[model samples]
Target: GDSTTPDAIRTRTLTEETARVFRSRVVNPRWIAGMRKHGYKGAFELAATVDYLFGFDATAGVVPDWMYATLAETYVLDKENQDFLKHANPWALHAMVEKLSEAADRGLWSEPDPELMDQLQQVYLDVEGDLEDRVS
Candidate 1:
């Protein structure tokens, strides 16, 4: 007999299915352009973050989709909270990124806690140095 529980269901998600669903959506370039507001520096940081999280060996494609799903879910669960995470600290930011990487490793992407998000945002902002100037 198979047990049915929310956690179990989530744990059993198929990586291939996740990837297929993402590919069909026809992503909007505006979003990528928006994220590019950070420019190459921002892009580097995000790439590094993803690399660190999901192990640098292989399966990079799977990790990004998981990252997107995690962020999307977080956004849906608590938009306000996610916004706050976009405003967190440096050390905390690095740590949250690591957590995300770990989640990706386990094939279970998830949104960071508000506190972790805060740290990540803060770190990125702090290291970014005058994000306003860079974005514009």
Candidate 2:
């Protein structure tokens, strides 16, 4: 952080780095497509990553509301992506949506769009219902 020249001082903190990586990887279409190629395990990784994200935010207070929205819009809500998760691993689908719902409920997504959150709630219920059908 400290540097001889004022201009040379490092500017990015762990918060920025975390957000950057999340945008480049998690919300990147190419990365999502790549994950789709890996099938069940790929979906599992995505779901698990959300858990890690939530945990990190719980401790660091760095995750922005937009990041959660991106995860929902780009990953969970997109039809192709949702279908991929469904066929590859419905459990992962359920797990991921559950985490998102928890995040919103906990105020991580403090000012989420009403329409978007409404859709997410419906998706969560549908995913849970899908799981219920399989086990029953």
Candidate 3:
């Protein structure tokens, strides 16, 4: 008999499992809301997690492009989360946006949505101006 088992259907590919975890837990609305409840510390953790995702994908060839795209959409580009970070910790927001953009620029998210990139660039500019103003 072959080594393949009937339960092979339950075995998800690396990408599929990664996507499942990311959507169900990492980017879930409830999880995001819960993180936000912790104040600035929560915001910092969110940004740090993004960096970790980026790093793992950079080193290992497992993460799919859509994961990055969806994460950017659900976390950084969402207006509600954007507003929260802008007020609670603009620097974290800025870093998140910058990392996403870097991911795109490096082709980690090859063929990223043009419109989303445009929106992110605009947000980056606005956030940069605000930070500069605060310094001035």
Candidate 4:
């Protein structure tokens, strides 16, 4: 039967291709326009600003699990937990949608369920831990 597998593959390919475009169209221009966007005076400031949203250079090729987790976690975090997302990598649309679906299923957006919150928090922490291990 026709299934979501093919759609998933197509989505993955599209995400990778568009990420390259984002690097050129979004990342590049963000640097050029840094003075307006972040009041930055030079490349250093622009680089640091983009670093938060784009992840490290190596992560460009890998899917960003952290962004998806951030979206899921956002529904459950207290103010302190939200602060953790500043370090999250920007995830592809595919991952974000998947996480959003899971978050919805767990009712994270509709209610303050502690069990679901724990699950989302663990996912976020795990992704960060994995990234750290890979980088180190």
Candidate 5:
């Protein structure tokens, strides 16, 4: 008997879950070690690394509001992260934008930092535009 749900949806759900499990069990430990070796500091760096490894899905609802809030706060306060943000990978910038936008849309953060959101949006737009130009 066929289920009412679509096959694509089911497959995507299963794949995402499997990936999450794999990240937790296998990738995270090794990634942590590497980050430590590279002298990465603070929870924001760790969270960014997780987002990079897992790949951000705006529709997946994987990133929590608390994480977004923490990221926003860190972005403003951490001098090191401030410099790193300028050179962040395109994918990482996109992930940060998606997560922060999601949090803002849901009114998850009590007071969303407009400056932080604007900075991330600018980076995301610039990176995406650059990619598009490269493709074109």
Candidate 6:
């Protein structure tokens, strides 16, 4: 019976309703505080710092596919959100690629728009390249 609801519709509705709340309550305040303390300029930088401080599994090289898929479905679909990710640190951006790859592998989330995926992938590559250059 419950199968009557389409996955895309459910996901879109859930994300639209909760995205603002999640950003305001979970993301923004902490970002503002971090900006004050660490000079993070935007959402991407803040996400990277938070990921670094919390030591997300990707830091340990153990990315969970379902989690990444969920993140993409919930957070990465919007242009503004994707822009925030563009400025993310290398590790964080790499984690996004890993997540998206995992989603692709498992067919977990709906297919993201091709352009959005391309943009995110480009950002990931740019950040990774920058990090590599710094190390070299």
* Index of the highest-lDDT prediction: 2
Report the Cα lDDT for residue 53, model 3.
Answer: 78
TM-score for all models, in order of appearance? 0.24, 0.88, 0.85, 0.24, 0.42, 0.43
Q: Write the per-residue lDDT of candidate 2 for residues 1-136, one digit (tens) a residue.
A: 4366887876678688788789888788899889999999999988988898899888887889999898888778999999999899988988888888888899887888889988988888898888899899
Q: What tens-digit string does per-residue lDDT give for candidate 6 at 52-131?
A: 32233334433334444445543444455554554444455466565565445554434555665675577667767877
RMSD after CA superposition, every candidate: 13.6, 3.7, 4.6, 15.7, 10.6, 10.7
Candidate 5 lDDT over 1-136, as tens digits, reads 2256677343346446545554464234455445434443433465464454334434444544444555555542344544454344434444555656655776554456677677767756875786577689
Tens digits of per-residue lDDT, candidate 3, 1-136, equal 2236775546676667666778787898998999899879888978887887788778865667788878788877899998888888889889988998888888777788898889888989999999999999
Error of 6 at 102 (Å): 2.2
Report the number of clashing residue pairs per model. 10, 0, 0, 0, 0, 0
TM-score of 5: 0.42
Query: Could you give candidate 4's per-residue lDDT for residues 14-120 as a string of tens digits?
Result: 45654554456433534334423433233233334334333432344332444334434432243332332323331221233334445445443334345645665
Better by TM-score, candidate 6 or 3: 3
Q: For model 4, name the residue pairs that clash.
A: none
Model 5 alpha-carbon drift over 4 Å, by segment? 1-33, 36-67, 73-89
Between candidates 1 and 2, name the one with more favorable lDDT: 2
Candidates ranked by lDDT:
2, 3, 5, 6, 1, 4
In model 6, residue pairs whose N, Cα or C atoms come closer than 3 Å (at least 3 residues apart or on different chains), thus clashing, are none
Which segments of model 1 are wrong by more than 4 Å? 1-108, 130-136
